[model samples]
Target: MPPMVVLSFLDAPVVTGPARGLIHLARALPPEVRLHVAILRGRGAGPVPPLDEMSDGALTVHEIQERGPYDPSILARAVAIAWRTGARVVQSHSYKPHLIAMAVRAARRVPWVGHHHGWTAENDKVKRYHRIDAWSLPRADRVVAVAQSARDIVVHEGVRPDRVVVIPNAVDARDLSTPMTREEARAKLGIPEGEFVAAVVGRLSHEKGQDLALRALAQARAQGAQVTFALAGDGPDRAMLEALSRELDLGLAVRFLGHQKLVGVVYKACDMLVMPSRSEAMPNALLEAMTLGLPVVATRVGGVPEVADDGEMAWIVEPESVESLARAVVDCVARPEERARRVAQARSRAAERHDPARRAERYLDLYSALGVR
Candidate 1:
């Protein structure tokens, strides 16, 4: 049998960011490195069905009960699972998975790492999440940050700087992106060909700050620059943003298209992508839009500056300043040539920065260094 490796994440198969990253990494690994994934808890018993049938030697996934930090019983269960699967190394992502691995390390005796994937200190809920994160990171042999910005958090919270690995989120943008015709794509997406299009391509929530983006676009449209805004993705704040839209009199101009699975289509469909997130770890949506050659107008928070160079690739605005964002949007929409240049620059740069093959090779180096079985 190949050298077995155990991987643990919050979601067993399908999840938004961290889980998807874990899945793709397994596929990219050499086949000789056998893999298993464990999930701490789910809505009910067993692995989620569709993915359960799909997992095998290359990926073995499971779910189990867990309580507070470093729950010994749960960690023991994980160690047993790894042992039976012949796994010689264990890796974990997110909070509970990391703690359990840490708790049971004596028994498992396997080299392990924690892949921290969120902005833990920027807001309230995440700070609570980071308390757990802070507790667990030191116990691991390696600590991986999805962005340099993410690494800053742990280091500020006082994790040794040397232990942190800043490997960013990676995607195959070359396969995912295609150059688009603005007139044709606008017609396909049901927007009039000449109308200025601005979009916010994430959940309508506090952290994402979609409301600010919408207000900015509304202000731009009010200036007699024909404009339309699309709020793509569904979340708890959908109704709130809708109410704010009506109160702000941004009817028809701002359309809410909920939870679009084909987000790549969103990139091609919009003339510009706007992300005014108050905080982010490393935004996949923004990266997606850039890869598809859409000019991005986003807030300079979190890992955004790492990807977008203001005026070179995309416009970077301060968070919560509706007027500043409005000014940037108006400037771009007024000049067609400038928009095209910005789009081209953004597309090429996004591909260069976040290539999955390059990220996978980095993980390969980390795994090899740890002597992953």
Candidate 2:
């Protein structure tokens, strides 16, 4: 069988949560299925040297150094690579890749699978991309959404419901389950002993609602909750969020650990994980924390309910509401027994739904259905 082409044309390097998820997927594929990864070149983006170390000769990385918006040369390079590799299936992971795949199908008639992680029209430029995705999606042989919420958005864009598949993001069950007590992790990270730590692990932005987390943390502290909020990712909104934290007088109560490469350690250090995203579609950070058996307080938005299962495995609160978020945080901190129960339930469900190898097997099945033997 020809190798499968997996396109990851991210604007930046593989530092973000989504990029890490893709790495996990690539490393998890069966050895018999050779994989070609096509990635855009940008800050932190380059030849993935670690794939050589990790994949046991099953993966190849291509760095496409195309640098302009709406550039057809990038698509040309992707098509040339696929044709040269005799790729039986071309799988795309974002709007750029999807558009490129659409063009490639016209040229080569190769089976195309478009993968949607999530969608956010945060501005006019993003709205344009959404339009582009809607325009090109019908050309794909299959469309994979990381969550049902994402699938619903695609279906609303007029694609046939059957064309879309929901594939929840997966986590490597090994690294997260490594034996590390919260105390040991906190010591390693220099967090004060006995301080309640709630971590928000994502890019600092309005859409991610890190600001909401800050407000909630402040409110919880005011109520004598004794909890500190740690933000584990950085973005353009970092300065703004820092300003808000100061305005709320959250001195020393908030820590900004920018771009955590060892995210599992961060999860282990925290007493609980909190996701205050105003919008989301199956956050991999939440999945990873849950798989590691961490208690969680997440906003009931997007696929969180699906992951949380109506509060069975997490304390779910309404999005963009600081009062509800504060309440959940305070309750989670005060009730250790309840948190432990939720953590156990979360681990069981995460193992059942988000195992990395199982996710790879599902993709293999999808590849077979696409007529790649």
Candidate 3:
């Protein structure tokens, strides 16, 4: 196959789940596969490190400044990059890039692959943006959904069933191969050694359900569970969630660590990971925690059940149910042997099913089917 160009948006200081997955996929691809990344960066955005620094110079990176959502110059610049690189296949992540890829395909006749990382309709503005995504997805040559449930949603939105594919996110165990011990990690984070730590790692937003996790934590503590909750990652909902935490009188029992750059350290310091998302599509945190042998108590939504079965690998609960979530946490903390058994199975499952190299091979197969040689 000729060189492939991946179009994405990355303006945050900390690497997001989709961006991290892209890096892992690029690194795991065979040495023969040439990948170029075209990043559409907003003005005054945070510093984006060179892709070559992360990929060991294996990827060619292009940064295009985006003026607004409907900037016509952005399309011209993107098409120019495709023509310059001779990209045979153009894969795009997120909504805006999907639109750009469609335009690029029209101008250059290149195959477009739209990657659907589930939508976050946190506000009216975002809901309107997602409608645009729904309108653009069916036009792509192929649509890649991170989970089966995500595929179902897009299909309902109008994408052809045969055109959509389910590819769960991948995790590299080697990234946390030599994690710090629990004692050392707790010391670094200033967490109490005697408390059982359950971490919720994601953006602080309504869709992420950090507030639900806070409510569950309060309920669990009321039931006499000695667990401390650690909330990681930063977003628009941080202030609201912090105020709710104080309202619950969760003093000294909850810690808000904003946008952890070294997330593996947070995983090491915690005894378990809680994914209380009201909505998700193959969360990278779940896979990372599984790879690290940390037991998980995740709400049964999106692609979570596809990754970890309830009572088999990780404890699964109903979404938007504080009582169910609290019960799961309390039960998980009460049963030490059960946590050990589940995490053992979870680690093995993560390594076998979610390996980045394996997922990259699947993408290659898809590329071949698209007449890229």
Give Cα-based local distance difference scores for all models: 0.73, 0.79, 0.86
**Global Cα lDDT for candidate 1:** 0.73
lDDT of candidate 1 over 166-244, digit per residue (tens): 8888665533444556566555566666556777887667889988877887788888667788888887889999999
Task: Report clash pairs, candidate 3.
Answer: none
Better of 2 and 3 by lDDT: 3
Report how far off residue 116 is in candidate 3 (Å): 0.7
Error of 3 at 113 (Å): 0.3
In model 2, the runs with Cα more than 4 Å from the true position are 1-12, 42-57, 175-184
TM-score, per-candidate, Cα-based:
0.86, 0.92, 0.95
Residue-level lDDT tens digits of model 3 in 1-373? 4445544433333466777777777888776677777887776776565665666666777888878756789989988988888888888887778788888899989788998889877899989878988999999999989999999999999999999988889997655554578899888888987889999999899999999999999999999999989998999999999999999999888999988877888998899999999999999999999998899999999999999989999999999999999999999999999999999999989989999988998888888888875
RMSD of candidate 1 to the true fold? 3.6
Clashing residue pairs in candidate 2 are none
Minimal lDDT window, size 10, model 1: 49-58
Predicted structure 2: lDDT: 0.79
Residue pairs with backbone overlap in model 1: 3-373, 233-259
